[model samples]
Target: MKITIWPAGILAIIFFISTSCKQNAPHEDAAEPAFVAHPVAVPKQDVMTLEIGKAAPDFRLPDVNGKFVSLSDFDEAKVLVIIFHCNHCPTAQAYEDRMIDFTNEYKEKGVDLVAIMPNSAMGLLPEECGYTDLNDSFEEMKIRYEYKKYNFPYLYDGDNQSIAIAYGPVATPHAFVFDKERKLQYSGRIDGVEKPGGANAEDLRAAVDALLAGKPVETPVNKVFGCTTKWAWKSEYGKKVEEKWNAQPSTISRLDEDGIMALVKNPTEKLRLINIWATWCAPCVMEYPELVALQRWYGHRNFEFVSLSADNPEHQDRALAFLEKTHSPVQNFIYAGTDKYKLIEAVDPKWDGALPYTLLVEPGGKVVYSSQGPVDLLELKRAIVEHPLMGRYY
Candidate 1:
């Protein structure tokens, strides 16, 4: 008897409700960025700290311009700092303001700041970490580098990672401070602070201030923590990449008369143990078994060993064959030239040029022992018995 709501009215009401619900719903948040994960497990290593009073190691590396720069170059400064840093580390990023302020405060005080980036793994090639890359394309690094207006150079560790390994630096922003006489004075965390927004102790700043005031730096070392250096060149290509970047003008890949003479002339005082032989020479061949053993015995010592092969163009093929045959543990290089005798004489002029000549050149280029024939291990061992650089195990 009462008029019921019509189906059309009900439909209209449902449609209105659906439309209202669609309009009021919240949107989903955008996806977050992803980072590349390490391929293998990295063992958590205890943070390493250098000791005070240890002689700060010296090293040379390329700046942004691909020029050689060394720690010794900053000798005139009253205090010197070598800081290992990277662009991506948040801990390192936190120090931007402090680094800038420190630079400004100490620049006029004759202190030098040298920041090293050991992130060679970030680049496709070993040489790409040059100054231009750090200055131009690395937005984060460039921004930090510019903001700091660092008085000192931000150096790149090219193919030869000699500096990073030498310092045993485990983190970004790892620091070592040296006094005027080049003795290590302080090393450790920038200031007892680890993460951002920590309480302000400023240990590093305090140490530097003390040194600048002509007072002894009481804090000699610190345990630095941050991202580890990711150096990529691992396999054969990696080796080539590193060698290409660190290639010196004086470096000779093939040992020739000219190269041997140059090394002999350059380091007059160091012990020079030159091993001359060839794959085809039989006695030069027969003695190789013993020579291979002797080479292994003394491989790790301080004396320089030049394993010269007179095989010329045939060197690579024959050397590989010899390596395959004996599974020889000795590392050897082939002498490439048409005239082997002239090359030998150029290295040492005293007598007839001969293969298997083993000579120990003193610091002054004096020949300690010159053996014209194949080397006897016992005889050679006796010659190097008490010698300073030849006593260590490989």
Candidate 2:
């Protein structure tokens, strides 16, 4: 179902519009949606290997201009090269000049070089990676192409990410080369240039060269590594980073009761995790990594998890110090001029609220699960498997 705003929020939105119109709103364009830092991890391939002889997966995607292009379109070509890339990923950007050189070199060889941006419709924020900005609409991608003078089609997979999952790409810059017979001959790193300049293992070039020689490609594949394909693998360290960040003094470490209440009121179909924790509690601190794991395991987008710090004002600094150290994902908040009971009751008077407590609130503000301790990943994963929602979060 489409999002239906509550009557009170609708009135507020109307009031906001009216207030904006009255002031002339000179800086209206300056407002931006808050950008959350995604949980980080070592990039690795989720798929370890691909068989040498199999038909390449076909895909249809839109170029920068929103024109549809398909894999089968190059049926007459002897070699079809597909590059899984994105505008914002550093690894893809690092190889920009090299990609242009490779595409140019093989075009005359009846090689169909198609570079595709396989962004998942879930989890990621495009603007965070510099792919899109506040002002970047589909039109902006086209303008960027002309401005950058790109020689290849910069395609977008807008439709529910059907092509990405089908291709099973493990990371950005994933290259696959197919012979004219449409059999998968090579798959792996662009040039074994894992970092900026390692050795020019040149895996893709070697495979292409072997195929062109009318000989079997010596190496069928290698372990591809780099910034992971955000759409391909689920993240597993949401709370670990948050705990690390929370330990830092520079970060704001309070759990704002008012802010959490607002989010509860504006809930989405995504699964919501509500954690009540404190600074002095060792169990809470110890379980911090698991919570982050739950978030990352849920892969950030699948679950909406927020943290409420129960530390007193005097301990706020220490709490923040811990947050900075661990890099927590639980949306930080604090309760002021109120006891825990009062605050919890005010948020929801239906039952008693306890420390180290977690509630899985589904959309429409329905409580799915409530417990007094840290959540178990296997149990939560089972729940997600059982219940189907439009958007899910851990």
Candidate 3:
């Protein structure tokens, strides 16, 4: 009779039948029932990255706990789950809770989990890190681990991604299951779903159980789908995006004290980020490139970004040239007033006239954030994305 093979039901039946036949039959070949389910095809990246049915390559990566973890160290386990995970990818973040559950479910049953960060932080840019709080860096991983209280060992391999290369993880949430001999058994996603708690960890769980029960995994090489492993060469991709936005025409306009106060008061229908910088200020020049990236990423939404030049009134041409060269995509202005103190106070009375200052102003001129120095780009985005008024737009 043809049967649909569910992991739990098929395993239970196979266990009963195999045990009964062993108890009654002689020590000769007694034909046992075999449950066959077609395995998923491997992805192109996996074919290039890892060898199937081979001994797992050994690794000694440092975990978030400050201890070194090697693959061979877990030889005591009947089956080990090696996951290529990272802190940034939303797909990886979504699977965190389920990954914890999967490990806890089988920890005492001679099964264990080791998660590897497969992307290099050097390859990561701030724009590629918009979804999560933590970057894929080891230090950020520690912060995430402590904050999340993960049950399994999270190893950092991103400095080189050598282990990631050896195992061939195509995506952040990809996994590989190995039997006691440390031979690769299954490699792919933990489940088919990409969202948090979307699918049961059936693929991974089934493979682990099968190996523990002395049965081969039914689906050995399912394809993984998530953020690609960020190789070092991909670092330039973010720069290209920045360059594209910078290539667009940059324009500047004159704003008198009344007009400048209007932008500060945010008469327009959007959240405005006002930056006070001068062409000659070193700190302002240093922060301009990142601010340009931010303008490109969020300027299309219900948000606005502009730079106000603190340059002298006669130096308006110099300020305009700087704005164009820096690729400030939004509207730009030159302070048209004589009193610098009045202008700084008009923006915010709590002001010390400082170069490279910033303010995130809500509609109707409510000042949400005011900074006297170069803004921390990552932290600034996080604050805006998490704010009650601005979160929904993102």
Q: Judging by lDDT against the true structure, name the best candidate.
A: 3
List TM-score per model, in order: 0.41, 0.46, 0.69
Give the residue spans of candidate 3 off by over 4 A.
1-52, 64-68, 104-108, 121-127, 133-151, 197-202, 209-216, 233-246, 257-272, 279-290, 296-304, 321-330, 340-356, 361-368, 372-378, 387-394
Could you give the candidate ranking by lDDT, starting with the highest? Answer: 3, 2, 1
Q: Mind giving the per-residue lDDT tens digits that candidate 2 earns over 1-394? A: 8997679988999999999897885775775443222222333444433467888777776677656788878898888888777654556656656777777888898877777776542334332332211112234456546655777887765334456656767777788889999898998888866454554437888898888889998888877775565542233343444455456443454435666576566366587777777777777888776665455445434466676677776677777777666676456765653567667764566646656776777787777777676666446544643355512111
Residue-wise lDDT of candidate 1 within 74-122, one digit each (tens)? Answer: 9889888778876545466666566667777778888887888765443
RMSD of 1: 20.3
User: Whose TM-score is higher: candidate 1's or candidate 3's?
Assistant: 3
List clashing residue pairs in candidate 1.
64-131, 187-220, 187-221, 187-222, 188-222, 268-363, 269-363, 282-285, 300-394
Alpha-carbon lDDT, every model:
0.61, 0.63, 0.78
**Candidate 2 segments whose C-alpha is farther than 4 A from its true place:** 1-50, 125-144, 194-201, 232-394
RMSD of each predicted structure: 20.3, 20.5, 20.4
lDDT of 3: 0.78
Write one digit per residue (lDDT tens) for candidate 3, span 1-70. 9998679988999999999997987866655443222212222243255755888899997888667788
